[model samples]
Target: MKVYNTNQIKNFTLLGNTGSGKTTLAEAMLFEGKVIERRGEVENKNTVSDYSDIERENGSSVYATVLYAEINDKKLNFIDPSGSDDFINGVAAALSVTDIGVLVINAQNGIEVGTEIHSRYLEKAKKGAVIVVNQLDHEKASFDKVIEDATERLGKNVTIIQYPLNEGTSFDSFIDVLLMKKYCYAGGKLEISEVPADQKDRAEELRAELIEKAAENDEGLMEIFFDKGSLTEDEMRRGITVGLIQRGIIPVVCVSAKKNYGVGRMMEFFTRVFPSPNDVPPPVDTVSGNPVKCDAASPASAFIFKSAIEQHLGEVNYFKVMSGEITEGMDVVNNKTGNKDRISQLFAVAGKNRTKVPKLTAGDIGQTVKLKSARTGQTLAAPGNNVVFAKIDFPEPKFRTAIKAVNESDEEKLNEALQRLYMEDPTICVEYSKELKQTIISGQGEYHLNIVKWHLDNIFKIAAEYITPKIPYRETITRIAQADYRHKKQSGGAGQFGEVHMVIEPYAEGMPDPAMYKINGKEFKISVRDKEEYDMPWGGKLVYYNSIVGGSIDARFMPAILKGIMEKMEEGPLTGSYARDIRVTVYDGKMHPVDSNEISFRLAGRNAFREAFKNAGPKIMEPIYNVEVWVPADRMGDVMSDLQTRRAVVQGMSSEKGFEKITARVPLAEMNRYSTALSSITGGRAMYSMKFAEYAQVPGDIQTKLIEVFAAEEKDE
Candidate 1:
């Protein structure tokens, strides 16, 4: 393998819609560069980019594939990530380390929802981009219409550098406006020919437009274009390269990746026009809070963007050399985990295939095996540098499911497998909900969760079941109520006897103000009344006041009584949900000195609190979430109507770009599988994101049904 410097390295990520042929384009590039002997198809499950079992089975790319090729002594590293929204984190991770983004658009479909989503990401990252109109050989392909659509959506910075001369069935040749020549494919070989007379006028017009756009990058070039009427080939190339690096021009190229039509020409353009690593600005160091340049002589620092767990290989961490050089046996420290790790081996990766390399220079992408502590989005730098890179920002998981081991004994194994899987894909989150008493797994969507389940079953051999997670509803009182309870037991050893009388009421925002109060007909000066308000860790308030007077109950036994009340609160009297925002005042109680142990008072308090709760105006509160749905303008009415059916409160509605943005607050119970529902309603053209807002009272009918369901389940148990 040949080592390349930062200037010779061209790092770019292929991004597009799910069926835009991104993997096919990668395969074509590899074959053209002679990195592979032949191109592989996604349907055949042989493409280098979609090699994972899940991807092959799903007939789509699920993970990002690292591939590299050398052309004209320059190394071009391509990060081909899954185009589906379910796996969009891979694209984000790849973009964090790449210099350019090549958006592959299906000519037949033109611009779709995925294209808009990816374009927004590219804009947010502020990275240069090239639009590749792929699938030109498709029967319904239209180069002109697609170009118009691309320009409208991606802004006027888009310029056409190449176009198919005869699209659709007869798409075998294309005219390169920059080179003023034609490239025709014949017998598996490319032949250079003169531009056809019929297309010459259009090609020249496009060329003049390209020249004008390129000249805008430099003042001198603009003056020369005005005076000389045209720029020399060398001058034009330099200006275009400058425009591309600054994103002043986003050149469009045409290719039929499956047939290898015009792919080689695309590769040539990447090597000549795309910006190198050195051309891109440096990223900020999270620890030092300074920009770190891509300098090999500086302190060595690298960032792990992706990680994969192979059966035999254990863990393979894919990283980009951010600064300095990474070599074998180099001792480094993980900034995020604060664990020291030694790079035992460095290999340049092409899909799952890797070749051992002595060292990887700055801006180069490579992988190493068996790191003890490093994980994705972690920075590994030299010991003295103490510089940590910013972590890659992945979208929050939007869908959740409760996972249970098929066999009770496999619970430990199931947990371990989930941990390992989460390490491999940070977007997949695993959480243990103590309130719900279930292991919850969250991911981008249904497809994402399905992949996780598949891995748990097949890779770890741990059978598991996924079900809709239980909502963490809360119980709270709305009115004041009083009750008394006496617990007495005669066990022959020492009889237990205790009595408790308590007043319960709904806890308001500012209750229990410091003041004097009377309890048990005694004038007790309650100076620290405000201190009785205890903020519950799980949210809301739990106010407890000791109002017993005349030593009716010992001070030491008050904690026990509070503990008993807390236990009752944990498992509420109605529906067994956790209770919140309630005040319990133990005004009076009786105790037998011999039988008045902590246990006796505890049972007395517990029973008293349960009695008061049943008398109080108890209500069930379900978790509500703020949901924002983005859909096509024409489907706004349909989405709004659907939301109303789910008892959602529409907060606002607005238009953004070409989509309608709808904001609403909906109960979590009503949002189960809502992502799937939205996709179905909009024909997979809508997207939504949600976050917890606040707990709201469930509807009367719904609350009744929930209580009935819980009681039935308890009876069954």
Candidate 2:
């Protein structure tokens, strides 16, 4: 493969809904570029983009397929990512390295969940888009309705560059407004000629609108357009180029990827109308907050946007040269891990096919193998440059489940394999919850994690099953109570003796310290000799007041007493959950100097704290999460009713980009398997995100049930 400069390269991502034929479109593009002898179909399971085993089994893309095509003396790098929301990480990875998103919309269904989702992502990234209305040859294809839907959903930026002449099963032609020409296909061979008289007026009107929209992006073009009341071919291309780069124009084109109709013309538009690598804004350095220009003379720097383990290639790392150049056998330091690695091999990748390249300049995407400790979202730069590109902001996981090995002995293996998977896909999150005592795996949706499990079961040969994840609840007290306990153990040689008197009360912020306590009409005046406060790891504070006057109990055993209290705090007395927000006051205590020890004090402190906690009106608290759910307006009421059943507190409701968004606060326990349920209820047209809000007391009925369940588990143990 020849090394292409930044200006000669154009990178784009094939993004759309699952059934929108992105893979088929990629295959058609590759075939048109002569990279392949023939086109491959997605239904035949031989498309260039969906080459992986899992993708073939699913008849869709699972991972982002990084491929390239040389067309019209220019290199076009294409990243075809999965369209299912479950595999959205692929979309994120592709978007991070591409300048334009070629959204392939199904002609039959104009605006879909995936279309809306990917459009929002493109808008968020502030990148340009080329709307490709595919499947023009399908029986149900409707070009006019698609234009209307695109205008309503994607705004007026969606201007038509091409309109199908006959969009049905016999669809074989389209009129290109930019060139003011007609493209017809007979036996899959394209014929370009003048627009017919019947379609001339409509084509002229669209061309005028296109020229005006394009000219609006550049002052010189606007002057020429205003003076001439039209634009020349060269002037239109120049104006459209600027419009695309500035995202002022989102030109829509039509293609029957299956029949290869208008595919080459679409490819021509890509090279001539789309923004080149140098035209788009270069990535910024996260460390210096400066733009990394696409200059080959600068210090070498590359950012690894993705990494995966190939069948026979070990681990392959895919990166974009953010600045300068990346060459084979170049030595660079990973700014993230501070580990130097040698790029022994570099190749231009087209799915599974690789062409060895001597070097790739800035803004070019390539893959390499055999790097030491290089991972996704890391930067490899020259020693002096030390540039790190800003990482891709991946969406948070919406589904979670506890995964365990079906065979108990495979637990370690399962964790190791999961970590490897996480390295390939950052959206596949794995963490062990110490409080819940389970290893939880989370992802974009239930199907996402199921794919991970599929990889484990098939690739790693590790047997695993997902179980219900346990919620990390908390326990706290509501009232003040005091208790006294004594620990005395007598033996032939020595004895252990310690007595403690403690007052327990709920702790709240901005409250005064210990002063006086009136318990059961008995007033106990207290003097705080020494005070120790702790910020508990679980959420709240644990304050310890040592009121031992005159050193009644020597301060040496204070730590031991605190340790015992902390143990009970970690494993609450009622339900074995972590305790929080309570203050312990040791107003009085007695100890035998000869028999006193840390163990004795620890036992006395533990028992006294437990007794007082039981009498202090303890309650269990569940974690609440701030949830934002986006669903179609028709499904909003059903979603709200379901959330109410989960004990959700509706915060607000608003409309967002053709979807109704509902914000609610709900307990974590009620949120298990919510992603799956939402999909079922909304017919997979809904999307949502959740974040931790705060912990609140559980309802009285739920609290009783939790305590009973905990006691049953304890008895069984």
Candidate 3:
């Protein structure tokens, strides 16, 4: 690999809906650049970008692949990202690093879901964009329809830079309107010729439009065009580059990548018209809390934004150099954790292939192997620089499942694999629930988790079985009551004697306030209230209290009394979900200096908490999620009706998918396996996103059923 000055580099990301010919277009560009002997076909699973086994089997890209082509003394870095919606994160990461984005659309399909989503991201990125109408060689392809859709959906700045000379089967040539020449492919070889006499008039008309659009970006060219009504070739070229960088006009090119038609001209357009790195301003940290100007000449500072675990190479972290340079064997500091690390081996990646590089300059993307603590979103910098880069906020997980090793004996391997996957993909979350006794894994969707487990089994050689995860449930008190317990055991040698008196009260609804359970040696007084107001208890010195009475309870045994209450908090008063946000006070108690040991007091406190919870009115709490579902307009009725049945509250609706985006709040319990249900209702065409909303009181009837179910399960366990 060679290092090119930033001014000589042009970066682009290829994005569109599945089957939109992104991979094929990349192959065609490579073929035209003479980088590859022949253009590889996607159907044969030989395309450079879609190189993974899963991608080959599924016939779609699941990761971003990096490759470059040199044309006209300029280096063009092409990032071919996945088009499937399930792997959208890869597309986003690719876009974040590119200087410009070329949105490819299949002429047969027009604007699609992916087109809309990625267009929005590019708009937010504020990068120059071009729309490529591909697959002109297909019998069903319609350039006019695609152009209309692109103009209407994308914007009016889109201008045709080239047009196909023939339609469908006859599409073997193109007219470059900017250059006023014709390039035709004959027997897979490119031939340049004068514009045909038959289409000369039409070609001139489009050429005039292209020239006029370009002139608008340059004052000198604009004056020439206005005064003389004509642009010289030199003036046109200069204006085109300026227009492209300013995005005042976007050049459109026609191509049939499958047949390699017009690929050479496309490469010419990219090298001549696209803005290079130096032409565009560099990235600045926008993390709000701390911002750093990217410095290419300073000590290395890079942020790890992507990670992967290969079969033989333990871990690979993809980072963007924001300042200075990164080289092998240099010690780096993780700003996120303040931990020092050594850069082992740095390499530039092309999908699964690794090409070792001597050093990576600022604005370049490269990977380092085996940094023990570095994870996605972590920023690595030179030893004295304390800059933390802006973090990428990932989407919330939509699907969750409990995973267990199939053999049970491989539990340790399962844990290691899960941890490795978590480091590789921050979007994938893993956890262990002591109550449910299950190891749960969560991801963006079922497809996301399925692919993760697939990689674990095949690549990491760790096989595990996954089941739908359980909903997290909690229990609390609903009313006030008092209870007492005595622990007295007479043994041949010694006796355990401890007494606890306490009052339990219900925590108010819709508030995360703490409850107060007061215990005197003889009786316990508790006050439970909602967390809306700050009504801290006074005159009682305990966990968070102030005044302690004249030794009502001996200080020696106070620890035991509190321990009993703490144990009961873990065992819910109602349905056995851990109780939370409570204050316990030991107002008074008796202690025999000889027999009142910590163990006796601990057992006594535990018994008191259980008795207090039973006396208090206990109830169950349920989890809720904020949901947004995007479905076609025709499916609005079905989605609304389905949400109603699930007892969801519709918050708002917006436009999406040439359809409606419904925002609602629904119970997590109802959405345990909602991905399947939603897919079924929308015929697998709708998409949804969800995140934790807040905990709500379980409905009375449902709460009863939950209690019964939990009680039975507890007994069985």
Candidate 4:
């Protein structure tokens, strides 16, 4: 393979909805570039991109596959990510390295929910993109409907670069407005000629619009277009590149990747006009806060975008050269990990096939293995350079479930496999929740986790089952209460005698200290000598006051009392959930110097606090998430009704792009399987994201049920 410089490289990622022909389009592009002798079909499970056994079984991609093709003197690197939203992490990983996005849209479906989602991601990433209308050979393909939907959802920036002259089942030709020519595909070979007389008027009209739109990118081109009302081919290329880089234009092209029609022209546009790595903004060196430009003369820096474990290969890491040139047999240091690694070999990847390359220049993407330690989002740079690229901002998991091995002995092996899966796909998050006491695995949706389960059940040969995860509810007081307790135990040793009187109250910020607390018509005065406040790790505050007058209880025992109180706080008296935001005052206590040790005081304080919490109107608080859901306008009512059943409090509703955006606050317990429910409600045409908003008190009936359940469990244990 030949080494290409940054300017000679065009890095792009294919984006679309599932069944939008993205993998097929990649196969066609690979064929056109001569990288593959024959194109592979996804249904046949012979495509180079979806070569994984799991992918083959599912007939879909689950991870980002790195592939490359050469366009004359220019090298085109393509990262084909899965089109399903469940595997959106693939898209994010691809976007992190690629300079532009080639969004393949299925003409039969027009703008789909996945299309809208991927487009949103592209825009949020601030990357330029081109729209490819694929599957024109389908009998139901409607190019006009696609164009209309793209204009509406994609904004007015949709520029028609190519339009199918004969769409639908007979699709074989298209008019290129940019070139003012007609292209026809015969026997999978492209033939270009001047626009025919019958189509000349239509071609000229579209070309005029293209020229005017392209001219808007540059002041000089705009002036030329105004003066001569035209733009030369060379001038238009420069204008389109600028417009694309600035995201001021979304050039739309037509193709039938299945039939190999117009695929070559798409490749031509990629090589001729797609923004090179050097054209877009540079990635920042997080360590030095400097933009790492694509400069071969600078220090070497390669940002690892994805990682995987192959059948034979122990571990493979794919990266894009952010700066300088990296060659085989080069030593690099991961500043993030502080681990020195050697690039033992370099390979230009074409799916499962990898060709040895001498070196990869800046902006090129390649893979290397045998590193001692490294992970995705870490940068491998020349020693002393300390270049660390920022990690991709992946969205939090929307679906979560508790996973456990059927055989308890296989838990360790299951955990190890899960860690490997997490490394392969960061979106698949795995953790053993200390509070829930279960291994929680979260991802995009049910399907995403099912794929993970498939890996464990097949590849790892481990049996695991997913259980409903326990909600991390919290407990807090709703009223003030006071209690007193005396721990008197006469064992074989010294007698243990400790008495504690504590007044507990609901904590509020900026509230006056309790000079006196009146409860049940009884007033108790406290002379606070010292006080301390703590920010509890479980999500609230703990205020402790030393109100012992005249050293009634020694100061050394304060810690013991607080520790005991914290034990009760951790295991709330009502429902065993972590308790928060309560102030406890040790107004008065009695202790025997010889008998009252830390244990005695701790017992007394624990019992006294537990009693007070029970009388303080203790309530359960469930985590409420601020969820934002995007659904098709027609299905808004259906989605809304489903949310209502989940006890969601609809906050507001609005319109975003061409979808309805509904925001609500819902209890995490009620949202356990919301992703699956929403997908069913909207016929898989909707998506939503959730984040922790606040912990709110549960309804009285629910709280009562939770207490009863906790008591029953406690009794059983």
Candidate 5:
């Protein structure tokens, strides 16, 4: 593969809501570029991007697809990503590496969930973006509404570059504002013609707006536009490029991918004006804490943004070269882990296949095979450079389920496949619960994990089953009490006996100090809490003073007692939840020289802790999260009302660009499928994100209900 200069490379990600024609547009681009001999439709399961079995079955992209197109002397790297929130993991990862974001909007639907969802990420990425209003040939298509939606939702930066001469079913051509000419699709090829005299007035009006916006970016162009009140085609083209590179303006183009109309023009626009890697900001500090800047002339340094497990290729690490050239057979250091590995083969990916390349230069995206130590978000540089790229912040998994292999024979295979999938998808998380002894796989939503299971069964041939995840509810004490127990045992050897008495009480608002626990002759007192400080129990140990003043209980049995109490704390006495921050003092006790050894005392301590727990009041605690839902202003009232019904506490509301950003705290237990619920309420037009804020006390009734349910489930399992 040949390396392209920064200006010769056009890297962009195709993004938008499902059914927005992103894949279709991508196919048209490929077809027009002649990269593919023929265009494949999504409905036929032959599109280049959504080529996976699941994607074909669903007729939507399930992962990010990489394809290349060399058009007009420019090499374009097209990242076609899935738009569903379930598969947004791929979209987010794609945004991390791309230079431009092309948000496809259905001319009929105007703006949908994906339009709002991906726009936020693009804004955060600080990448230049263009709104592609596609499917103009469809019946009842509303290009005007889409344009209005684009301007309303995307902000004033949006500028029109083309206007449909005829819209909807009549849509056949577009007037190129930059060229002041009409380009019509004739015989599946773009043909330039003079602007229609009747439409020339409209064309000039649109062209004037375009030129004014373009001129706003350059002083010379602004003076020319002001003096002559018009801009030449060449001047407009140069001005658009400057505006795009500076992210000062976002150009819009109308296309009917179904008719393959305007695609060639879109390609021309990208090759001529789209910003390149050198025009975008460089990668900053990665999680490993090293900053890397793009330097085509410097030693090799690249960052892997995505990884895939190919049956024949093993591990393919897709990366973007930020500095100098990286060649096959050259050793590179993983700045993250300080491990060095040789790139045995480097290739440029085209769909599922790869074109082997001798070297990949800076600003170019490529892949290396069989690099075991390399993974997404890791930086690779010439040995010892220690440069790292910026880390991609992955969204938290919104869904979870317990999974188990179909048989013991496939357990290891299942584990291996899941691990590989986890490495490939940062949003997918898998782990085993020791207490439940079951593996739980989690992702953005139910559909997300379903795809994982599908891959595990079909791709890796490991059958598995899933169950609803355990709520992770916890138990705590609400009141104080005391209990005592004695352990006496006699085996075939010497007899053993030990006794313990401890009191259970409420912990302070924070953590319990030494004063919280009191040693007494007839009563024992200790307090446990549910606050952050109490969460740190100093390894579940509390020092007991030798206040006996006369050695009431021998010091030899204290360690055994402390050990037993710690063990009991781990296995909750009430409902098997870990106990927290309570002090146990051995103020008074009895001892037998021969029988009161560590083992006897340990048992005594465990029994005593259980007794105290039974006497004290117990409660349940649920996890709470801070949720920020961004919705249209018109839907704010409905969203807030719905949140109230879910027992959410609305913190406040703020305006964000064009949406209402509402912040609230809600229990995680009540928000398991809030994404789906929010969609239902907003008709799939709202977007939300949540993070674990803090844990709060569950309501008394709900707490009791959860405890009962948990107890029943534990018994059934």
Candidate 6:
């Protein structure tokens, strides 16, 4: 392999819907560049990009695979990511690091949900794109219909660069508008041929439209084109390149990746027309808020876009050099972890295979072995430079489940394996909910979680089960109430004796002003100086008042009493959920100095608060999430009806492109297995995303059932 300069490198990411032939297209491109002697098929599980066990089993790409090929002295790095929504993080990460996106579309199924989703990402990233209409040889393929559908959804910026001369089962040749020639595949090779007489007029019309669109990229070119009625090949190429980089034109190309039809011409366009690495602007430094130029002589800085764990290779981290040159043996610091690490080895990766490289210059993508602290989305810079690049923003997990080891002895192994898996795919979130006392694993959907479960059992020899996660409901008071308790224990040695009188009330931002209250026909005045408010770490507030004016309870015992009250707050008196947003006033209490230690006062405080809580109107608050569902317009009615059954409040509805977007707020408990249910209802055509919104009181009927369930569980334990 030969080293190429930054200007000679072109980085692109292949994205589209599952079964859109992106992997096969990449294979064809690699074969055309002579990087591989033979093309591999997904059905045979021998493709360079989809080589992982999970991918082979699912017959789809799971992880983003990187491969490079040299064509016309230009190094083109192709990042092929999974098209399924379950692995959208891979697509986002690839887009963040690459300059151009090659969106492959199935000629038979044009502008599906996945196509719209990826197109949204492309627009958000403000990157250049080229549409590749693949699978032209399919029986139902319609080149003209696909082009029209694409233009309708993607807008007028889409322009045709090539079209199949004989599409559908007989797709053997395509006419190139830019070159004014026809490319035919015969005898296992591509040969230049003259345009067919029957399609000559159609080809000429498309060529004229292409010239006009390309000329619009520059004023000088437009003037020249208008004066001469056409553009030279060199001038047209320059104009198209500029238009692509500026996102003013989205060139459409046709190909039959499996048959290798028009693949060589596609490679030629990639090498000569696509934007190079230098065409992309530098990224801004996250810490200093300054643009960091891609200069080989500057301090070394790189961003890790993807990380994976291989059986024999351990951890392989793939990163793009943002600035300066990274050489083997150089020491760098992980900005996120602040851990220093030495680069022991560097290699240019082609899927799972790697070739050792002495150095990787700026704008080049390469992989490195075992960095102690480096992970996905981390920025690594030379020590003392202190440069931090912005991290890759990954979408939040859409589904969650509680995971527990099947065997008691495998708990430790399960935890270690989960951590390793998290390092490999940052989208897999493993959280230990301290309140629920369960380990929750969240991902894109049910299938994603299942994959993780498979890894746990097969790779780590630890079997685990997934269950619906328990909702972290909160307990709160609604009314004011007072209660008194006397903890008098006459156990033989050191008898405990203490008495506490507390008033419980609903808490808000500003309330509970000190006032006079009478206890047993006696008037006691509470002062503002004895009140304090505590902001609980979990979520809510607790306002405590120590108003013992006559010295009935010692000042030293107040903390002990507060600690007891907090303990009860953590495990609420009703349903054992965390309690929040309440006010408690220990206006009157009696303590025997010798007998009333922390334990006696603690028991008194706990009993008094419990009694007051029972009198105060307590309600359960469940977490609610704001969910947005994207589905085909025809299925909107069915999806909306299903959401209503789950106690969702439909907030709004809108239409984008050809899909209906419904926004709603639904309780977390009602969303169990929602991903699966939605898939069933929509036939896998709809997708939804959700995030934490707020907490609201559970319905009266649901609250009654929940309390009963909690009581039963507590009795079982």
lDDT of 4: 0.91
lDDT of 6 by residue, 1-717 (tens): 666678888899998998999889888888877778899999999988898888888898988899887788888888999888888888889988898889999999987777888888888888888999999999999888888988888878788989987788878888888887888885667788788898789888988888888899989999999999999988888888888888888999999889888877888898888877667677899889998888777898999998888779888889999888888999999988999998999988878778888898888999999899788889988998788877787888888999999887888889999999988788999989999999999999888888898888778878899977999999998887788889998879988988898888878886647587664576657764477789987789989899886789988888878888899999987689999999988988898867888888888988899999988889999999999999998899999999999999999999977789999999999899899999899988888999999888899999899899999999999
Per residue, candidate 5 scores C-alpha lDDT tens digits across 12-95 of 899899899989998888887777898999999998888778899888888898877878888888898888888887888888
- lDDT per residue, candidate 4, 1-717, as tens digits? 889988899999999999899899999988988899999999999999999998898898887899999987889999888888899999999999997888899999999988888998999889988999999998999989998999999888899999988888889999998888889986666799998899988888888888888899989999999999899988888888999889988999999999999988888888999888988888787878988888889999899988889889999999998888899999999878898889999999999989999999999999998877889888889999987888998888989999999999999999999999999999999989887789999999999999999999999999999999999889999999999999998979789988899999999999888899899999999888888999989799999998998777899998899999999999887888899999999998998868999998999999999999999998899999999999999999999998899999999999988899999999999888888998888899999999988899999999989989989999999
Worst 10 residues of 3 by lDDT: 538-547
Computed on alpha carbons, the lDDT of every model, listed in order, comes to: 0.88, 0.90, 0.74, 0.91, 0.78, 0.87
TM-score of 3: 0.85
By TM-score, who's the top model here? 4
For every candidate, C-alpha RMSD to the true structure in Å? 3.1, 1.6, 5.1, 1.0, 3.8, 2.3
Candidate 6 residue runs with Cα over 4 Å from true position: 196-201, 217-231, 510-525
List residue ranges in candidate 4 displaced over 4 A.
none
lDDT of 6 at 448: 82
Model 6 clashes, total count? 0
Which residue pairs in candidate 1 have backbone atoms (N, alpha carbon, C) closer than 3 angstroms, thus clashing? Answer: none
Clashing pairs in 6: none
Model 1: per-residue Cα lDDT over 116-233, one tens digit each? 7888888889888899999999999999888888887777889999989889977888999999899998666899988889989999999999999889998899999999999876
Ranking by TM-score: 4, 2, 6, 1, 5, 3
Candidate 2 achieves a global lDDT of 0.90
Note the residue pairs that clash in candidate 2. none
Clashes of each: 0, 0, 7, 0, 1, 0
Error of 4 at 289 (Å): 1.8
- Stretches of candidate 3 off by over 4 Å are 192-251, 285-296, 311-314, 317-319, 326-349, 352-360, 366-387, 490-493, 506-551, 555-559, 581-601
Better of 3 and 5 by lDDT: 5
